[model samples]
Target: MTAPLLSVSEISKRYGAVVALEGVSLNVGAGEFFALLGPSGCGKTTLMRCIAGFETPDSGKLTLKSADLSGVPPHRRPVNMMFQSYALFPHLNVYENVAFGLRRKGEREEAIRARVSELLDMTQLAPFGARRINELSGGQRQRVALARALAPRPALLLLDEPLGALDRKLREETQFQLKEIQRKTRTSFVIVTHDQDEALAIADRIAVMRTGKVEQIAAPIEIYEKPATRFVAGFVGEMNFIEGEIARDDGAAFVTSFARLPRAECALPQGARATLGLRPERIEVSRDGEGVAGRVEDFVFRGEYTLLRVRVAPDVVLRVGAYDGRFAIGDDVKLTIAPDAGVLFAESE
Candidate 1:
């Protein structure tokens, strides 16, 4: 493995009594698109700020190419941050905004013009160089913001919820565009976002945070398929959680027994409490079959997919997918899950 472009080691931060981040560590390879994903107030932004030199951590170390960034100022560090709001100067034209960093560095007028022109072409905004910030659409403004951040040729780029300001349709379109731009530039990108789909779609690796801790760090597919904890299993996507006690654990398989469960699927350990996690999409529902009997409580049609809330045990209601089935609200259905499709999690104390 080559040396990481950026590495954060055991970083911790606190705001008086509230702990913002604790012992968070991550490594990003050169040119990799890494995402810090979590809900609001989950310390994703704080982590990004720390890397950008805007917020200093209380402990631990931040390194860029093996060099400490503790005392480095934001402008002096070989990093540039693209803010969520685009942060475009209202009074400056597109070219001037992209050229702002060059002006600060005291580059000659002719050199600034050439560098800005190249960036404009790189971002496909060459024709809009003369347009004012307010004149560009949301997607165009996003591109301008990206161009401005990339103009300085920073070794690493930090993005704070880069697509949060765009509407749904535009956000989806710009996600791919941003990935392409990152690949073209070959710059390491650390993006902070709360949208799971966005992280899964754009990032080479994702660090899922909760409260002030990283729950899991893995590729999108691995994180979605083999979540390490109950929090991760529940947070990453839709899941059916069935609670029971472990009847057996033989390393490979664990059986959990519930009152209504016909047989122990896989036991964990004798007397251990456990929960089975099955993704909604991985579950198969049939009109008539020998499986878990459940009554359809309600469902919503979502054009490309359907969501069904099925009442299984009296205490548990499972959310399942109905990709093509048209079972009515009051119909009974049998839900069958492939043994390998579910993961068993030990119940949290």
Candidate 2:
């Protein structure tokens, strides 16, 4: 009987024969940082646009604060969008850029200045208010965009690839600032991103979309540690899938050609085809141990961990995340996996 802050029900969109969204439905609670994460062309953008009223769904309904959004224009809705391009006015200085929405609404100069000052301080752009948009750095420009979007105090804010333009180093640093600002403002944020790391870092919940459908929706840890489906397991993180079938003889293990996998943490029916989804960090690589023997096919030295691709069988390869980079190419290694480190997904036909 009660309504959420934002609700989308069975929203479907089709561009001619191509289906951009199919029965997509989700809800964003007040002050929740939700992420729409997926690869390109998965319809994340379409769903966000539909929420913003820029694109109307053919067969479903959206409600914000229990009010129907049907036929509502984008600007009329109590929602603001921060585009991927930042969309700041090049000629308008930072202060004016953030104050544009308030001025457009004909707010008195005194009130506009106060609200703009508050947002600038909250977004850490107070000192840069007088700077031209063209003279600001990428991260500073992003802050201006955020401050502008939040100035209107809309119930919801839609961000389309907000950090896509920033370099990796800057993007990583800005992620913390973004989340902090969102927390301080308490505005519900729906961010569309292709970066899994970004989603894991910033979102309170993530909806993993594929082929226009939401495959799974959960907290980031739930998305990574207990993915609901095979598609979700593969999409959210670096998962090593061991193809096997459920074996009834054992308590509940995937019967793989290489070996009978450790008892799966998840339940699967007997004789059902199942896939074991293991994170690289779950498998420990050692020179010698009571574990599966495999030879290192190759290895890459990441800053915090060494990722080793080991051939454990003729047809199976497992990636192990090691804290040390002592592994060399063609070296024999042992991969130790705990019984509960992996979750099993029933393979669909």
Q: How high is the CA lDDT of each candidate model? A: 0.87, 0.91
> How does model 1 score by TM-score?
0.93
Worst 10 residues of 2 by lDDT: 259-268
For residues 1-349, write the lDDT of model 1, one tens digit per residue: 6888899999999999999999999899999999999988889999999999989999999999989998999888999999999999989999999999989989899999999998888788999999999999989999999999998889999999889989998899998999999999899999999999999999999999998889999999999998988888888888888887654333334343323333335545566777878898887888896877889999988787788999887788888898876889999999877657778787872
Model 2: residue 165 alpha-carbon error in angstroms: 0.3
Best by TM-score: 2
Q: What is the C-alpha RMSD of each candidate to the true structure, in Å?
A: 2.5, 1.4
Error of model 2, residue 105, in angstroms = 0.6
Worst 10 residues of 1 by lDDT: 255-264
Would you list the clashing residue pairs of candidate 1? Answer: 248-267, 254-266, 254-267, 255-266, 255-267
lDDT of 2 by residue, 1-349 (tens): 5567999899999999999999989999999999999999999999999999899899899999989999999999999999999989999999999999999999999999999999999888889989999899999999999999999899999999999999999999999999999999999999999999999999999999999999989999999898988888888889998888987775866688777766845467788887788999998888986788999999888888889899999999899999964988899988777878888777772
